[model samples]
Target: MRDVAQPAVAAPAYVVGSGRNATLSPGEIGSFLKFDPDGSGGLKPRVDVPTAQAVVDKDLSSTEAEPKDATFSFAGDAATVVPAVTGRTIDYQKTFAGLLDALGKQGDPTPPTTFTPPPVPPGGTRADPPPATGRAVNAVYTTTPPKVTTEALQAIGPATVIGEFQTTGFAADSGQNIKRVADQVNGATVKPGDTFSLNDFTGPREAAQGYVEAGIIEDGVPDRGVGGGISQFSTTLYNATYFAGLDEVEHKEHSYYISRYPAGREATVFDGVIDLKFRNDGTTPILIRTLWTPSSIKVQILGQKRYDVTSQTGNRTNPVPAGVKSLAGNPKCKPSKGVDGFTITDTRVLKDVKTGQTTSEPRTVRYNPEPQITC
Candidate 1:
C-alpha cells in the first residue's frame, strides 16, 4: 500500500556514438607485439666480470671462516647471512612442495584457476622495424635464427683443431690484395658484463678490417671481390658453442649454405653489425681466456663448475638422413672462370673433450652451387 510507484525504463542494448564511441568488440587495445625483455629498447643488463669475480672470492673467504652447522636448528646465528645457504633453502622448499603436491593429488582432483582477460583490438602499440644500415641489416639478419648441427656438437674446446686457415694469396690479411684479414682478435678474456664488439676488436669492415677486392662468397654466390671469408669466425664459434652447450642469443643463416661448414651450423659476422654474444650465467664467475701458444688461436672458457655443462648436437650423419627424403630443386650450379662452381654435400663430425675421454662425430656441410664472377 506504501507508494507502489513506477520503475524507470531500461536502456537499449546497442547504441552508436551515444556515449562512448562504438567498436565491434568490447576490449581495451594495447601493444599487439609482445615486448621482448632483451629487445633493443629494453635495458641492457650486464654484470661486470671483475666485479662478479670479486664477489665470489669474497664469499669463498667468508664461508671458509664460518663453521659448518649441520643441524637444521643448531643455532639461529648465520642462517640469514649466507646467500648460498639461503638459496639452497628455496630450492629445497620448491622441490619438496611440488613432490608432496603431486603425491597428494594421486586420486583426487581439484578445480583449476581460470582467468578471462578482456579482448584487445588489432593494431595498438606499433613496434618500428629495425634500422636499415649495413651493420643494421647484418644485425637484424643475424638474429633471425640458427639450426644446430651434430658435427658442431662433436667439435668443442681443447680438442678443436684451432687452425688459422691462413688466407695468404691476397695479402693474407690485406684490403687491396683481395683475400684480406677477414677478422682478428687478441684473445683477451671477456669479463662478465663485457661485450664482444667486432668493430672494437677488428675495426671497421673496410680495408682497415684487412681485406681487398677479391672474390668473396656472398649470398651463396661469388659475385666478385668485395668482403671475403669473414663469416668463418662466426661459423666456427657457432660450431664450438653447439658442443659447448652455451646459449646462442643471436645468429644469422647464410642466404645459401657454405660447403666449408656444417650446413646448418654456420654463422655470419659483419663488423659493427652482427656480433657474437653469450652470458656466463653460472653462479661462479667465468673467463673468456684465450691462448695463442701456437700458430692457431684458442678461445677457452673458464668458470667454476656450477652445473654439469652438458651439450648435444644433431647426428653428424643426420638423425634423420637425407636419404630418408630426397631434396628438390636443381642439383647443379653454374661455375665461373677460375671459380669451381660445385656443391659440397654438408659432411661434418663432432668431437667432445671432457676431462677423461674424447669422441668425434661426423656432420654434413652442403653447398648450393655458387656462381663466381669474372672481370
Candidate 2:
C-alpha cells in the first residue's frame, strides 16, 4: 500500500501564442505507479504505461498538427490566398520519461516537472491590406522560400517592345495562313542565351494544322501549296528580331525577288528544309507579339532595349534580262507580268545607344527575272 500512490505527472499541450485561432489544454498529464521489490534486491514497477501513452496518442493524433504554407489562386485580374495555419503536437517519449521521474518526488504539493512540447510546423500566410480591386496580387509568406513561390513570381515586370516591323498585301487564304503562323509566334518568351526558330515554333503547316493553299515560290517557280504565305510572316518576325538586337542564327533569302518585300532584307522559310532563327543575346528575356489583320501583318520584339539598330542599303548594282515564255493555245497558262532581274546590297548597322559606337554587317542579294508569259 505504501508503494501505491498518485504522483505528479507531466504532459505538454500547446496554446496559440499570437495571430493564431485555437488553444489547447492537456489531461491529467502525470503517471500512476505501484512499485514493488523483487526477490533479488531489484525494484519492479507495476505501472500502466500503456494506458498513459494511449491518452496522449489519441488526443494529439490528427487534431494537433504543424504549420502549413499559404496558397494563391488567380482569376482574371483578381487574386486570392488561402491563409496558413500553425499547429502543435506532443513529444510522447519525452513526456513519458518526465512522468516517470515525477513519480520519484511525489508530494501533496506535487513537484514541478516539464514535458517536451512537439514542434509547430510552418503554415500559410496573408497579404497586407488585401489586394487592390481589379489588380492581380500574390500571397505573402513568412520565410524566404524558393522562386516558384507566389511572392517571387509577382516581382517580374512586363516586357517592353523594343522593335517592330509590318508587311501588307496578301491573297485571302494566304493571309489566313499568315495569321495562323502569327498566332504561333505571338506571346512567345525566349530566355537569355536561348534560340528561337520560326519553323520549330510554328511547327509543320499541314492542312490538318489549319493551313490553306496559297502561292509559294519553290525551285525558282511559283506554285500553290499549303502554308505558302507563312514566309511573309517569318520575314516580318525576322526583321523585328534583328532590329531588337537579337543575334540571327539562320535565315534564307527568297530565290526570286518579290516586289512586296524589302530588297536584300527579307527572309523566307520552307517547312523543315529552311528556317529563320535568332538568339536572345542580351541578359534578359525576350517576348514576341504579333498582330495579324486582313490587310497587314505586324511582329514586335520586346525586351530591355540595349542598342540602336540602323541599316543601310546600297544602290541596285546588276540587272539581268527577263525571259519570254510563249503560251500559244494554252488556256491554263495565266498571263505573267515580267519581273526585271536585279542585284542589291544591304547592311545591318548596330549602334550602341549609350556609347555611340557602331558595327556593320553587309549582305548581297541577287534576284532572277520572272519569265514573261503570253496567253
Candidate 3:
C-alpha cells in the first residue's frame, strides 16, 4: 500500500524573533511589529515605536492575568478583591458587617407592589395599607403665625350662651386670639398695682365689628343687646379673682339672680349700662383663663397671689312673692302681678400667698330679680 497521507490541524503559534514572521512563546503575546488587518501573518512597520510599544506592553501585561507578586502571599490574608475601588482605605469591619446584614435579609419579604393609579387616593381602602397604622407621634406647630381659624371655632363652637360666659369668653376665641391682642395694648397689663378690663384683653367689643346682637333680659323683658349676658361673664371673672385673693376694684350685682354665677360676690354687667371690674391684686401680670365644661363655665385668674382663698359660690333664689313692688330704677315694675326672684351668695376662704396664711370670709352682693308678671 502507498504511504497513508495525514491531514494537518493548524493551531496558531506566536514567534518572538528578529524575523518579520517571528513566532513568540507563552511569555510573549503577539508578533513584534504590527497587526495585519489583511490577516497575512507578516509584520508591517506601519505604527511608530512609541505607539507600538504601548500596544505591545498592554498585550504583554494582559496575558499575565495573575500578578507575579500575588503568588503564594498570605501577608494580605484579610484583604478583599478590588480593595481600592472606593478611593479610600477599606474599613474591613464595617464592610463585612454591611455584607453580612444584606445576606441576613436574603429571605426578607419584599414590599408588596401597589397598583396605584397615577396619584394615589386618600383614605385607605381595602386594597391599601391601613392608613399607616402605628403609634405615631403627633406634634402641633403654628403653620401661619398661629392664625385664627374659622374651622377651629366652627369645630369647637356655636356655644350655648351659658348664663356664665359671653362672646369674650375664652370658649369663643382661641388662646392666641386673647394673648396676641392683649400683648399689643399698653395700660392693658394688669399688674399688682393695675386693674384690668376683660375688654382690654379681648380687644374692643363693638356693634359694627364681629359681634352679633344677642337677646338678654333687660329691665324685665328680653331685649336685643350687645354684650348681653356679659354679667354672667363678670361672674366667671369674679369667681376667678375671688379664688385668687385678688382685690376687686369695681364690680356690680346682676338685676336678677343668675343660676350659673357665684352668689352674692359676683358682678353684673350690661352694655352701655352696668359694668363689672376687678384688679390684678398681685405683683405680676394676672392672666385670665376661661374654660367651659358640660354643665358649667370655668374661669381661671392666674397670677402670683397676694393671698390664697377657698372661694365658693352658691345660688339662693329669693322669688318675688307673686308680686313684689319694684322701685329700683324701674317705672315699668309690675306691683300687682305674679312674679318670681332669687339671690346668689358667694363665700371666700382668704389666704395670704406671701405668708401662707388662710381665712374664710363672705363677699356680699345682691341681685334684684326683675318681676316677671303673668297678669
lDDT of each: 0.32, 0.64, 0.39
lDDT, candidate 1, 185-212, per-residue tens: 4222334444454446556656555555
lDDT accuracy of residue 247 in candidate 3: 70
Measured against the true structure, the TM-scores of the candidates, in listed sequence, are 0.35, 0.58, 0.42
Q: Write the per-residue lDDT of candidate 3 for residues 230-339, one digit (tens) a residue.
A: 45555666666666666766677766655544457667654445555676554455444455432345555433435645657676555454344444455443333433
Q: Write the per-residue lDDT of candidate 2 for residues 1-375, one digit (tens) a residue.
A: 234233323223221111221111223332434457788997766535566546544433443445543333446323343344543444444334434343434232321222233454333422222221111111111333321233321222333567789999998989999999887666576777889988888788899999989987543346789988888998899889878878989998887788898888899888889999999888776667788899999997766777899889898877887788777665456777777788998898888877998989898888887777777
* Deviation of model 1 at 192, angstroms: 2.7
* TM-score-better candidate, 1 vs 2: 2
Residue 223 lDDT in candidate 3: 55
Q: How close is candidate 1 to the true structure, as a TM-score?
A: 0.35
| lDDT, residue 236, model 1 | 50
For each candidate, C-alpha RMSD in Å?
24.9, 16.2, 30.0
- Report residue 242 deviation for candidate 2 (angstroms): 2.0
Assess the local accuracy of residue 259 in candidate 3 as a C-alpha lDDT between 0 and 100: 51
Please list the residue runs of candidate 1 whose C-alpha ends up more than 4 Å from where it truly belongs after superposition.
1-184, 193-195, 199-201, 223-227, 284-298, 305-375
